[model samples]
Target: MHKALRLTALAGLFMAAIAQAATPIDVYRDPNCGCCKSWIKYLEANGFSVNDHVEPNMSALKQRLGVAPRLASCHTAVIGGQFVEGHVPVAQIRDLEKHPELAGIAVPGMPAGSPGMQTGQVHQAYQVIGLTRDGADRVLASYPADSSL
Candidate 1:
């Protein structure tokens, strides 16, 4: 009976850990930016619990959060202690959550076919950039064509 109880407790603990693994995103953007609003909506649609914060100076907010220029975008977000820039796909965010060692993920400038920025059938190859606090950056993932979704 004791062994059975222990096994149940372990199972409960594992379930709790899975629940806690969902990514929590805090998005900072300019109040007047329509694209930023769309980005938040995109995140919500993709399973991230987004906490939106509108700021007068998004540039300052980005700087405060240590976002690099190469990763700059219309808005910024922090998730699990990592910065997320621009219209980053939710899949990449999930990938980041799985790999906790990554400093951050970014989509750089808004591409025409990116999540919230999707317009027409035009598609472009883009990179999800990973960056350190000191501004060191690298390509975390590359998406090609309009079918990247």
Candidate 2:
């Protein structure tokens, strides 16, 4: 009975490792960008296995990924065949699976309190903009300022 229990625990651990390995996302950022590193750490903590790529010309990469200048941020991530720009929250990132109409999502500028951009308890109002397949932009989610100051 004890042997069977040990085998079950081992199988569970093995499956857990495979699950972790399966949630891979590719992140592109400048090597000197500290916030980008923080964001990578945040993603890993949230169960994403990040493949960090340091790019010399971020503008070119963004352009290739169809990220418009107005929707630009410090870093870009590719997951679920969609581009994720800036410090978007994990919830929205995960929600990308449900929205096949969207080409990608962006947080625009790095707003304080967003995932990797957290500043203590302080957070700023921000919107997660989704770029549609037809090239129109829409608000997928909005985060209001933290009022519990």
Candidate 3:
């Protein structure tokens, strides 16, 4: 009976982990922005489930989400209660999930070669900026000028 009970508990934990993995990331972006769509595809290709929302007033949404104007980008995404701004890479997004201390992360502007913003081999250097709960901004990751990823 104890063995059966343990098996059941383990099955339940596995199911919970699967559910967490399937959690869809909610993304808000302007309908007219092609780069936003590209970013969505990029997320999907990277195995993330996305719930896309075409927000009419993105400025208000960004302000409400504690994303400062300085971190502005073409689109915004929310996952695990943290905002992801711009074309941040998948690796950084995964890192953000591990750090609850960060309110959100951003790649200021639409830099070429970052995820969906990729322009062939034209990879420009960029940094992933993190916003703390107390409203402090910090550099989380940096991609060098010649970086292909």
Best by TM-score: 2
For candidate 1, the per-residue lDDT at 45 reads 73
Candidate 1 lDDT tens digits, 28-128: 88888888888888887766678889888988888887777767989888988888889888878877876665668889898878888876777888889
lDDT of 1 at 65: 77
Off by over 4 Å in 2: 1-12, 15-22
Question: Over 4 Å off in model 1, which ranges?
Answer: 1-22, 147-149
Worst 10 residues of 2 by lDDT: 15-24
lDDT over C-alpha atoms for residue 149 of model 2: 72
List candidate 3 segments past 4 Å from native.
1-23, 147-149
lDDT of 3 by residue, 19-39 (tens): 677647899999899889999
In the predicted model 3, the residue pairs found to clash are none
Model 2 lDDT per residue over 53-116, tens place = 9999999999998998999999999998899999988999999989999989999998988888
Pairs in clash, predicted candidate 2: none
